[model samples]
Target: MGPLYCALISQIAIILAFAIIGAGLKYIDDAFDEDRFSKKKAISIAPIIVLIWICLSLFDSVSATILFSILFAVLLTGKIDNLIFKVSTIALISILFLTQMLNLLWIPLVFLTLMGVADEKGNDYVDNHATLKLVEFLFSYRFCMKMGLLSLCILTLLPWLYLLAFLAHDGAYESVRMLGKISVAHQRKKKHTIAISPTVNE
Candidate 1:
């Protein structure tokens, strides 16, 4: 209906694209054996994908930021395997987190969070700092802009909301992978014990 609404749709389009790509990467990894195609590595490229997206952001900030957030969420969810950590991290970032664009600055928080990433922490920090910048508009703007601000926050939080759903999903794939390892170990032990008991029966 207007430029603002058009911008909203464009950002949504980018967000959907990242979601589809994230899903496609997972499916591809699942289709192959772990040795042939590591799902970890597949999702690991999420940062690179996002870095490239950020480069494209210069041309379209709104759309680029929205899409990057979605992919970053997918990447973040892939790395962290704790519910309480994710929940607590989200709460803190929603309230206490801060970021800068020109310099890419954030507080030194070592807690496991989506806000950062490093070799030691694995997910130390995200390249995008504008994650919550639009929060001001939602509360500080005039009545005329209330609808627009509401729409922006909803769009901005979509990636985060999606990650929450993924984390709460019916047993994450990592858990299933761990179970598979345990099952193999259990079967091997059972067979070994049976083989040893026959020799002792004599």
Candidate 2:
């Protein structure tokens, strides 16, 4: 009964962590709306999301955790508009690959490359100054569509993998502290939001 109770609590905490991550990403999405998708901001979010996945992996199926990492790679690579962006994307991919290997790297690489190329080509729908328009369009439709699809795939696979693997085993209490970290993050965001709102209002 104690193990079951801990598992139930841990699962709820995991779900809430994901919900907070979604909220945090939605905050980024709002920022993207304001500045129209700054490449630097987008690149930075990738590692943060990956860190979240790494934390979750402690309590999730190996397959689901790996899928999360792959999706992180694909989504992060979409925002690359400069050398720094490419380098960061490559570094993250390499880390994930070296740590997790081919089973976890190949399919995401395929999706990343395909959707990235498509984004490069779909630059005609946003603005008029050719180069600027291309940048805008890449962020507007192509990145959004491709990343959205990949996120959908990750969400779809999570439950089945969890059931099959039964990751909420006895060691789950070891991971509950992750929820505290996420809560701290939320508090930080709240403080930042409060700090910035006054300036914006002024």
TM per candidate comes to 0.28, 0.38
Instruction: Give the top-scoring candidate (TM-score).
Output: 2
Clashes within 3 Å, all models in order = 7, 0
Window of ten residues with lowest summed lDDT in model 2: 165-174
* Candidate 2 per-residue lDDT over residues 127-177, each given as its tens digit: 434457556845544464345345635766334423222223212321333
lDDT for residue 153 in candidate 1, whole number 0-100: 48
By lDDT, who's the top model here? 2
Candidate 1, which segments miss by more than 4 Å at Cα? 32-202
C-alpha lDDT score of every prediction, in listed order: 0.39, 0.49
Whole-model alpha-carbon lDDT for candidate 1: 0.39
